[model samples]
Target: MAISFNQAFAGHDKMLEFRSERASVLANNIANADTPNYKARDISFDSMFNNEQSKLRLASDNDRHIQGNSTMGESSGLLYRNPSQPSLDGNTVDMQREQAEYAQNSMQFDTSFMFLDRKISGLKKALTGN
Candidate 1:
């Protein structure tokens, strides 16, 4: 029987990737905060997760067939944030809001990292009989 790491790690690996991508987007927004007409972009987790969930239907030609492994889909695209107050220069990046979002995203990324770490640790222990 072949075991796929995708099945073992579940969605943690994909979640980490998504989080990293979001961090980059957020950092870019912060970097261009002063640039005129720079629109702040972000990922919507609901959109990605919903896309993943939609692919999880069970279908089998035989009763003994194994179920398909469902993995999280890649991000469709970045979503633009509507500014609370439009700047005269047309820059949409809000430093305070961007900073808060960055911090929150960092925490979520850390959480996914910790979850994957614990899963790997547990698997190692199981294999080593520790």
Candidate 2:
């Protein structure tokens, strides 16, 4: 009795998770903008998603292929600090850039959530024959 959503939904799930994490990081950067010597950190989802090792799934020898943990493990994207600008107080956070990035990430997060909601709604309708 295996019940699962379409494979397309998997991508959306991953994207939503990534975007949510990115938003948190961006928010953190913005919150610590005034903190002296505080370095801004960012994640590279493109590189993380592109990694082949992260996309790998366990293959069972028999027909019963039980899904296991992702090969990517608990590792997130690579954290990097911006090198373009440096504050006089040794802080690396650029408020303008961080605000823009945060706004963009928020929009992306909302979009992903909306898409997932719509998908679930569609499934509900289908199951209810409505």
- Model 1 TM-score (2 dp): 0.78
Candidate 2 lDDT for residue 75: 57
RMSD of each: 5.6, 5.3
Model 2 segments beyond 4 Å from truth? 6-8, 50-52, 55-75
Model 1 pairs whose backbones collide: none
For 11-92, candidate 1 gives per-residue lDDT tens digits of 8999999999899999999999999999988877887677667677788999799887666554465778999988999999
lDDT of 2 at 64: 73
Q: Which residue runs does candidate 1 get wrong by more than 4 Å?
A: 50-75
lDDT winner: 1
Q: How many steric clashes between backbone atoms does each model show?
A: 0, 0
lDDT tens readout by residue for model 2, 74-130 = 556657676578879989998899999989888888998889888888878877999
TM-score of each: 0.78, 0.74
